[model samples]
Target: MRFEIMNAGKIQLCASLCMWLGIVTWTGNMKLHIWSVFVQQSYEGDVVFSVLNEQVNVSKGLRDGKTFSIRSPVTRKNAIEHRVFWSAWLDSLSTRVFGVEHERAWRKQVRDARVVVLEAGCGRPTNRLATFSDGTRACVRYGIDADQVLGETLSYYLAELLGISNLPPLALSKLNLSSEQWASVRGHIEALEWSPNAIVSLTEFIPNVTGVFIPLHLRKQQGGLQLSPETVSNMTVTYLVELMQWSDLIIFDYLTANFDRIVSHIFSLQWDARVMERTTNNLLKTINGHLLFIDNEAGIVHGYRVLDLWERYHRLLLGSSCIFRRSTVRRISEMKRSGDSAKLLCELYRAREPLARELGSLSQEHALTLQNRIDVVYKHIQQCTDIM
Candidate 1:
């Protein structure tokens, strides 16, 4: 299976190159020197095209009065920057949806509101759909083990720190029979045998969200999603927006080492070769096309503990992505430069979660591991830039 996947990736890479060459030829500005270099590189087993190669073709296209379908030159750097600019412009023209302030308000509401009812069937059997006194709903996750709750809470905050807003606002709650918040659901909690003082996480429930499948380009038998000039030029606006979010998702999962979403499917490929064709687990898309990253119980704590078995798959997924959000990259760069990523994360988790002490903080070892992963990601970004 591994060999087959590798072979498929190579074939897809070659096909992408062929498609790019066709585009260049069609534009009627194909240069002899560029063709010669491409041939030489192909002979040397260096199939990845450099950003400069793309720039030359785009410049030639413009000089020859050839117009591109997309607004920007679809080179790696330019395409990514243009998409980022578009996203920012769209935000400026309208009230920012799911912006920082909106998330902050949602968090406050979920944290302070009283839980008026708890019923089964949010996503998992163990989780409950909670109705608050204010008529808002949240998905209450009752962790069979404490680590699940911890992972969910910490991962949400980590995403927040990285400026990734795809994750819904999350808050921690303690089960207390005497508290008014649990008064209506006290018997329900007892029926489930939840501990009185246990801490669980409540994520703001998103309505009318549809399941999201892994993008076709990222599937097992294709060359992973590449921001090559031809590829981006052919993409629709909706595709560009989703791809932008996906780039952030890859970075987030990599940093958290979350294996439940993409990695698990990759692992399953060994047994079920068609697994990647299915909708990804714990991922959903809103009616308006915003992705909601849910069910992060496998992030941080459990993910780190089992890293030895899954790190290779995690690295594979991370390596397959190149384009990224500028704001996310900036935050990562700042964290990498300051060398205080661990401290900053710890402070955020401790300050925001009142039950943090009771639930326990991330261990020094895990904190160090988190810092190391951040450093690795920063270096990966540098490597991507170097290729550009």
Candidate 2:
């Protein structure tokens, strides 16, 4: 229940609450500055954005079709430290300091917001620019498949269930789009919609992010560029090594049988060295690179199609070797040894039980399936741990 708020070039990183005029909190892992806790109502339930009652000009973050470049240099020392920091954070997830309860509260605060659709991007599932009612802007994806969206939601729950940070806060809400907005998205849609309100999943977009250094499979999909595994690994290891998130993400994908995670979907945040120097923030200054997982709508399909898809991508997870850190395995081992793994699973089951009643049919069945898969995943973890 703690957040470090940055304002007017000053940062306060403590758990204690203080009263300040027009305060806004950083809403994502990027730690980029944005609006804080101002509540309002929209067509959706509750919209919380940063600007409260004041008018401020905040950048919507590269919406003008500019190419974001990754110019920040990554050294060996920084990469190792980044790996260590992230792995340690993953290990801390199941503890009292960062458990499911905290995850729920934090997620709710970040996910519920009223957003306006900006520019729409290409793909089967589309990307859009959206601004919160409080004027904080982000990129979003509308859920094309109800089952997939439910699975994505459950994945967040699973991340909470495992006490790890996977995807950023994904808000499930209705959005108001103008006629222009409707026209912009018409090519991507299957049916007609005169109605201005549409239910969408809004993922908190990170500002100043450059495209990630994708894996070979993703590169092939993009344009069929082939590079040796060593060359690719060497390039990626400059900015990422021992990526604990990859381990957890792959485990999640396996549990859900998701296969859409191509390398191009990962994002890398940009660091302004000049800004870092001015702020004198040690954390930001020391580790200038971070990776994020996005586009999680391909999981938990309702039919046999997922089986075909899973077969295609399962090797990425259970591969003989990759850049993923074995931190997830170690964490699982620690949890089982401390008698918390089973307890944690019970907590997840209880948390998901009501959803089984609320969502009904496919989701309800999938909820039960999810719990069963948790058992399978535990066994998988045991196998990995034994080998390790």
Who wins the lDDT comparison? Answer: 1
Best by TM-score: 1
Q: What digit string (tens of lDDT, one per residue) describes model 1 on residues 1-388? A: 0111123234533333343334223333442212111111233333333321232333232312222312222323334444222244222212222667767788788776788888876677889999999899999998779998999988988987898878888888888878878878888899998888788898888888898899887884544665665566555545676777788889899888999999999999999989988999999987666788999999999999999999999999988777676678889998888786868877898898888889876888888888889999999888777765
> Model 1 — which ten-residue stretch has the worst lDDT?
32-41
**Candidate 1: deviation at residue 311, Å?**
0.5
**Clash pairs of candidate 1?**
none
Give lDDT tens digits, candidate 2, residues 211-330. Answer: 443333432323222222233333432223323344455566665556555311221113332221221110011112344545556655432245643454454443322223345545
Q: Candidate 1: deviation at residue 185, Å?
A: 0.9
Per-residue error at 147 for model 2, in Å? 2.3
TM-score of each: 0.76, 0.49
